[model samples]
Target: EWAKAFNPFFAGENADWLAMIPFGILALILYYVGRELLLSGKKTRA
Candidate 1:
């Protein structure tokens, strides 16, 4: 019971989860663009 009262940072749990959302989205988008460029660089119909 006292431990809960002692910690104040736990209030940001949802905020912490929200913070990572943009980074995750950017990383996924980066991977997609990189993959597209890498495959497009190859020229061959075999």
Candidate 2:
């Protein structure tokens, strides 16, 4: 399937599930920070 083709582990013989933990955490932190900044900007403009 297309999903497997794009997966980082699909092309490799080994899958590093543990390596994804940090990246996942970073992604969540970035999402929250970006959301907060966007909301703050809107409040100031209003």
Candidate 3:
């Protein structure tokens, strides 16, 4: 990921918050995708 090299450029001094964006976005996408799959199953009415 270009984020690696770009990080030092933008991160500057405070690296903690700068590094969290990628990880936070990943977790959010995974959670939403999993939720969609879980709710995808439907029951048929007799």
TM-score of 3: 0.49
Q: Runs in model 1 with CA error above 4 Å?
A: 1-11, 37-46
TM-score of each: 0.49, 0.46, 0.49
Q: Candidate 3 residues 1-46, lDDT tens each?
A: 6755676736567687767889999888888779875455786799
Question: How accurate locally, in lDDT, is each candidate?
Answer: 0.67, 0.68, 0.73
Candidate 3 wrongly placed segments (more than 4 Å): 1-13, 37-46
Clashing pairs in 1: none
For residues 1-46, what per-residue lDDT tens digits would candidate 1 score against the true structure? 6534564434444666766788999888889778785345767788
Residue 27 Cα positional deviation in candidate 2, in Å, after optimal superposition: 0.3
Q: Ranking by lDDT, best first?
A: 3, 2, 1
lDDT of 2 by residue, 1-46 (tens): 8746776665544457745778999888888788795344545544
Residue 8 CA displacement from its true place in model 3, Å: 5.0
Worst 10 residues of 2 by lDDT: 37-46
